[model samples]
Target: MILEIAQLQVKPEQSADFEAAFAQAQRIIAAMPGYLGHELQRCVEQAGHYMLLVRWRTLDDHQVGFRQSAQYQEWRALLHHFYDPFPTVLHYEQVAL
Candidate 1:
């Protein structure tokens, strides 16, 4: 499986709003084909920071399948603007576990 780890640094006072928007946003992603599962986490050290951990059947499932789908637009509309300086999303694969 391909694992995607997205780190989001939200604006100071926008955390609550961002989370609310993401509640709807997650449903869109979860409906997409090839979606395995995901977890969302808030950073303890950085209050406004968040992380999205998702697993896919393959890299293309995320880079192409999900991103190209219309649901992604809704996801972006809801969550993209809440980002402060934007975030870097990286993907990896299981090596040992």
Candidate 2:
């Protein structure tokens, strides 16, 4: 599986609104092809910071399958505006322990 992590910096005053929007946005992503699951975590020390972790069957499942779909536009419309400088997204794979 591919783990997608997003570092989100929301506008200070709009954290509550951002969370609300994400509640709706999550449904959209969850319905996408190859979607495994996800988590949204708020920072303890930084009130306006959030970490979004998503699991996909493959990296292309996110980078192409979801991001390229029309649903992504809806996702962007719902949650994009809440960001300040915008979020940074990265992908990872499990390593043997």
Estimate the overall C-alpha local distance difference test score of candidate 1.
0.91
TM-score, per-candidate, Cα-based: 0.96, 0.97
Write down the TM-score for model 2.
0.97
Best-performing candidate as measured by lDDT: 2
lDDT of 2: 0.95
Question: Which 10-residue window of candidate 2 scores lowest in summed lDDT?
Answer: 88-97
Task: Give candidate 2's error at residue 19 in angstroms.
Answer: 0.7
Per-residue lDDT of candidate 2, residues 1-97 (tens digit)? 9999999999989999999999999999999999999999999999799999999999999999999999999999999998888889999999985
Model 1 spans with C-alpha error above 4 angstroms: none
Alpha carbon lDDT at 58, candidate 1 = 91
Per-prediction count of colliding residue pairs? 0, 0
**For all the candidates, what are their Cα RMSDs to the real structure?**
0.7, 0.7
TM-score of predicted structure 1: 0.96
Q: 30 in model 1: Cα distance from truth in Å?
A: 0.3
User: lDDT of all predictions, in order shown?
Assistant: 0.91, 0.95
